[model samples]
Target: MVKITNKEAICIAVLFLLGSNIVIGSGMDVQNDNWIAGIFGFAYFVPFAFMYARIQALHGGKDLPEIANHLFGRVFGFIITAVYTWYSLHVGALVLRNFGEFVKITTLTETPLLVIMLSFSVIIIAAARLGIEVMGRLSTYALPLVVLILVFMEAMSVSQMNFDFVKPVFVHGFQKIARAGFSAFTFPFGESVIFLGILYSLKKRESAYRIYMTGMVISGIILVTLTLMNIFILGPVEGDFYFPSHSSFSRIRLGDFLQRMEGTISVSYAITCFIKASVCLFVACKGIASVFGLSDYRFITIQTGLIMTYLAFILYKNTVEMENWVINVYKYYAIPFQIVIPLLIWIRAEFKNRKGKRPKKSEELEINGGEQEEAGNEF
Candidate 1:
């Protein structure tokens, strides 16, 4: 029900697309499988980006749940909506956990993990409670700082770059590299599927394709460039170390006065993570509202945030356990819900169109006209 301008929608998409997931997830993928993972990751977005654009074009300013309801019936529609709602919360929790681990390991080693989580939950809940407009505005303001930190990190580390490190890039077997690519693509890029919920709020639906695809392309380029840079500076061996990008920043030295700038990346990542979490929280609420027929969407934020916090706590026993979950559970659980369900809805919409037998609410009302008239007469 909240109206947003095209520019605001684009900004939100960018925040959703290039959040802590890319920063932390990319590094995690690279650490797991070297630079090959980045390559596969980029490829994963190709179809995902197209699927999103196609679904938006077909629906024309409707969320996925609405589209599902149109093509399917209310029963199935509610089911799909519930699945998406769960998916969004699960993703929110996963990203929160990832960020919590990153901060605890890198910057705030002494801070209790629960304290960090509660702090993050408070910020995310606050932003979500302010509504989508504020979240979009915050992203517009924060994106520049995040980009600047990335640029500065890349610039300062330029001298340390060694192309030879990424050389023999396919030194790993093609099959292994391809598998890594599958993992990368699924984690950061395919996850963009969640943004479909907000596409209807854009002032210009036609521009959704251009804005989203462009954002993904830009995000992919950045991720690939960062992966290459990490490999160049840290070598393949060191790139495998946890938080390679942070480590790369730690090595920066600008005439001895501009040192220890690694925290700059951390600051940027924190802001990006906040925006990402906010967007996920908003989408989760929207999906729930659509499912339960809630008149006010903002009311669900606290309850959902609490649920998300508890889910994050239960998601992983530790960082290593979380990483294993990301590799195994996430791909299996997320892919079907994120990719398959939307694809089915889109296909059903088209097929129903071909049959010229799509159901409409007006038709349903007309069919029940006698009962309505009798009830009105009784009243």
Candidate 2:
């Protein structure tokens, strides 16, 4: 197995969470209430950051299932793994479907949804097969380009920005803005909880927390800044339109030479979505492998990819329905597995540590602590 450095782990985690779907989805809410949403996003990270640090501290090198079984019994461990696996696949499908719809509406109006799904799924499978190191390296290369494009887009729109749009921002009352902020925090920031699986592969524990916190802060800043820019350039009335970033890009006209820069934003979004999907796919496969006692993870990627594709098709009948589902269902359904399960694991770990307990002797003998060891053997 390839050991990941703390910096590499952080980069992958950041890119995985700050991808196109998150930025676009969260950016929409921020446009409505920039300051409030931004603060909410920042606040959402507090609990997650603590849980993540505690998990790593308790079991830095172990996978989720192992950690679960270490703290809970074998049955509970398998249940937790199953829940996380389901969440990963469901989220992956949601992202894939969302991106496909965005492309159909904005760029590839004539392309078949199946073709779009297949193309993206094939790329994700290939990336997972190559292993997590390649994903990290790929993100390292792609992230800077994405950031540069965003910076340019923001800079070009500066001249047209009307600070008056954000004036008297609280005129809508703090409660409405606060609600929007909570929605923003839960989706993009809280979603970072998924990174715990991959992050344990990091070599340096100290750097893990620093990179995670830094990435969270940076992502929050970018999101809030983009929200403010969208509101300033497009005005609140126009900003409320679907895909405000796309709309903002469409309005860019630099001396008639640099017009219709929406494609730039589209390209960046597509790349980010690709990386995010790949990361989710990897984690799902890894979780399943851990649960099923598999030695080779690549074997499950294609099967899981097919399952994800089907799930994507079933997730939403149409774009509007998908957006509604995301706003309503995702928050409640995802939080228990994503945030609550991990919190439980952390608490269990702390309790065990305080009482000075370890796994039974038979459990340690069965797996010998090998990375690929199964929970049944360990328990």
Candidate 3:
């Protein structure tokens, strides 16, 4: 069904991982040393990423819902799939609200948050309607623009960096760094759990290990670099800005010729965020279809997108509340869905594989010298 090459899958993963982190910046609790926290966060998430990849390889073309139903039994699997579907929707809404808040506070000061969110929701719903294949192909193009934008932002602001801000390693002690690293793992890194919804569409199931591992490593580096760049560009007063990456980008100016670069960078953030929202919505739709025994997920894309828009509106009263929730509440709220349940699934998959339940090579046909194609799905 819905086939995508390993390259497309990895691109989507990188962009999805970069998503909101580009706008809000990650590991913020540690302030200037957030990069250190991000590095450790990536380290902490490495094993789990491999485990997730293994789950994909073991299950082959089976998406998470199917795997759950087969491994956990129908009733329990239905419950687990429902919970994960809800988590996907909830995370998508949180991200939609984040971008809405960013736009409202920054460039579109007068634009209604509802309008901004609805606009983005329409785009996301359209992309979801196009299905996973289209989404995967789209990432092949969009990710490069995002990468270029990040490079430009870093280069343009290179002169503004202050070496002094990086002094006194772990100035706030290891506790805060660990806390921030935990937050980083949960929010961005651990959230890769949602990939189970569609990564099954990957052309060659064996590529899951390479896809997940490579994407996470690249995204982790980008995230850590952005965090460190913020510290360097803003120096000791980096804490003064809520969106440090955006603030740092705003400082770039090549004598009025290249002024206001954050505008371009802001567009890049929106592109990546849009990809994240689209993937989340698409996954939620697939999960719903699987749970309810529907043939296709097309019918519910609009409904789910609108629902996400409304939930985003009611998610937080303002940016302040949202920021507080992300920094303090979201970490704990996201842990069970992203880590606990996924761990359960991984354990079961491993047990099944050991019990000779692994899918045979015949289940998937990889031919044409790796230029693979999967069975088509009209859905």
Candidate 4:
């Protein structure tokens, strides 16, 4: 099996977290306190991150579907695996649509969304054909550049930023803060659950916890920074814009030289979203292959990518529905797949592993006793 180091895994996870987040607000409902909401969200995801990492660490070096099937029976495993694959496929489509929308709305107004998605799909399919190791390498190179762009953009826009915009903090009260935390957790942060499929290919199984924790911490910091920047630049109306970061950056004006710097945000989104989409497709294809007993998943990569492109085109009527669904429904909708299944799997893995190890421990004790008795007799 192809193996990726924990470093590469962390890179992939960071980019994945930042992908849709660059264009989407984390806690838009709370307006100026979005960064606080982001903090709460990260805190909420920490324990589950450990759970996810521990499960992957325990069952490392195997594909997720294979692990599931072994832990559960073939039929039940197939069912759970299918659930995860579908989540990846559907989210990949959502990521694709987000990319298309950003490009279409921000740059190519006349260009067709389908064409834009198709173009992005071509690259994702290429990455899939190349393999996970290549994907990791690409992420390693791309993440630094993408992050640098974010820093540069934030720096450039700093001159125009108004610190008072985020004033009157926490006026929304604890319930609202907690609600925003829940929303943020379910999205960009909690979605880390999907990394189990990717983490199984890690070079060092023990690094799974480090990868998840480090990835989330890095991405969480970047996200909180971006969230604060958006609120600082856009004020209470920050939540009004569908793409808050882009909107805030677009307002930058450096004596007409570097005006409308939002293009850099587009470039950033394209790079990270591409990585996210590639990972999703990789996980989905791999799961499908494991289920059907296929020898390789690369055979279906192109077909799956194209299907994702098509779904991207049809998933929502416009950005308004996308926003509504994201803010209103997505958090609750994702609970079963993101929270319930992973929790069940982790609990089962702990139980089965402990129960399965008891026999080995007892057997070892018996063998040691026999060896000691033999030594006593000889002496």
Best by lDDT: 4
Provide the TM-score for each candidate, comma-separated: 0.88, 0.90, 0.92, 0.95
Estimate, for each residue in 19-133, the C-alpha lDDT of model 3 and write its tens digit. Answer: 8998686635776777888887898899989988888899899988998998999999999989988998988998899999999889889999999999989999999899888
How much lDDT does candidate 1 score? 0.76
Backbone collisions counted per model = 2, 0, 0, 0
Candidate 2's displacement at residue 364, Å, is 24
The CA lDDT at 233 in model 4 is 89
Worst 10 residues of 1 by lDDT: 24-33
Model 4: residue 177 alpha-carbon error in angstroms: 0.8
Q: What overall lDDT goes with each candidate model?
A: 0.76, 0.75, 0.86, 0.88
Give the per-residue lDDT of model 1 (tens digit) for 1-379: 5667766666666667667654555433434246667767777677768777777777777887787787789999889888888888888887788888899998789998878988899989999888877877777787777777788789998877887877775767777777667766677777788878777776666777886777777677677777777778888675445566788788888886988878887887788678778878888988888888998778889999988888887887887787677665666666786578767876776787666765578888886997889999999
Q: Order the candidates by lDDT, highest first — what do you get?
A: 4, 3, 1, 2
Clash count, candidate 2: 0
Full candidate order by TM-score, most accurate first: 4, 3, 2, 1
- Candidates 1 and 3 compared: the better one by lDDT is 3
Off by over 4 Å in 4: 360-379
Between which residue pairs do clashes occur in model 3?
A: none
RMSD of each: 7.5, 8.2, 9.1, 2.0
